[model samples]
Target: MSASRDTRSQDIIDRVEAAGLRIPAWQAVCSVLETLGEVLPYGTAAYLASSLPDSMGAEVGRHFPADSSASQVDRGDFVAAVARRCGCGVEEAERAVHAVTDAIAATVPFGVMVNVEHVTPEPLLDLITR
Candidate 1:
């Protein structure tokens, strides 16, 4: 892998550990972040991007607040996006979402989670709430 890839991987691992999960959770969480970054409105995406490290900022930067409101995707579409991004089955993708978000809920500050939740759409509540 290139040095940049290695650095990005390391940054992700550090973040996963900081979230009280091991490195294994990185892909799922990254998928969620990318999907949100792709689909959220500019203000909402910026809210989430601000919480992430600089290394990760670029992954979502391109689509973060895409030109049209049509860029927004629904909850089922989000799950499918994660599945397609991870090359996993929908069930597994859903499980990963639940696991990753649950870890975030456990480790991230409550206020930050609330801020994120405020930016998230209603159909996706189960990703964090359940």
Candidate 2:
């Protein structure tokens, strides 16, 4: 990877760290989403990855349409899925995802965030904002 790309990835991580989550837990949240992406339609995973740096987008995304009939998981289920991936309880996972999403949201304008909301379901937005 180019130095600029590395810097960009570190920039995202540095921002997440500033939001008060450690790298490992943030990584867990990301890993969980990447796995969830495999089972979901590409759109949700793609949009969710938009707030991230390119390498991270790659890290948390891979196969899509793994379940041909699958769609985006709702918020609670999304939390549960992430929890399972991180080997943590659901509530704990909620905190982790919440923190990371909040941090990412902080980097974008409110208008962009609203656009994100348009593509994202209400429940999922609640998960991030609440």
Candidate 3:
């Protein structure tokens, strides 16, 4: 990877780690999504964070139609395309993609919490930005 790409990936890893959500597995996922956000024209990172699986799957399918039948290839290509678009090295994009895929796999079972009354969005967003 190039120095800049390495630096950007590390910066994202460090920021996410600092957020107290640093499960070794999830860190990789967040990194990829961050990179995707950096690369893709559309807001994939935000969509992944907020959308349901079916919606995200459809979006992913629509934007990256590699082989109508083989979704994994499309997903991989999408990540690579996003990385290329974002100006990141291929290795960096691959790492980010793997990390994100792993993170999503792990988080799916836990489900999401919607108790806005208890959660503070600012601190979480601040943590991510910082």
Q: Which candidate is the best by lDDT?
A: 1
Error of 2 at 62 (Å): 2.0
State model 3's lDDT: 0.39
Task: Point out the higher-scoring one by TM-score: 2 or 3.
Answer: 2
lDDT of 3 by residue, 6-120 (tens): 5544544454344343244233443444433433323333344443244232333344322232212244455566465435666655554544443343343333312211231
C-alpha local distance difference test of each model: 0.63, 0.60, 0.39
Show model 1 residue runs off by greater than 4 Å.
1-24, 67-72, 106-109
lDDT of 2 at 44: 57
Q: Candidate 3: list runs displaced more than 4 Å.
A: 1-67, 71-79, 110-130
Q: Relative to the unseen true structure, what is the C-alpha lDDT of residue 24 in candidate 2, on a scale of 0 to 100? A: 65
Candidate 1 overall lDDT versus native = 0.63
Q: CA RMSD for every model?
A: 5.4, 3.7, 13.9
Per-residue lDDT of model 1, residues 9-121, tens digit only = 56555545455432256676777667767656677566556554554555556574463463354888888998887678787777766665565455434775687677667
Q: After the best TM-score superposition of candidate 1, give how far the Cα of residue 82 lies from its true spot, in angstroms.
A: 0.4
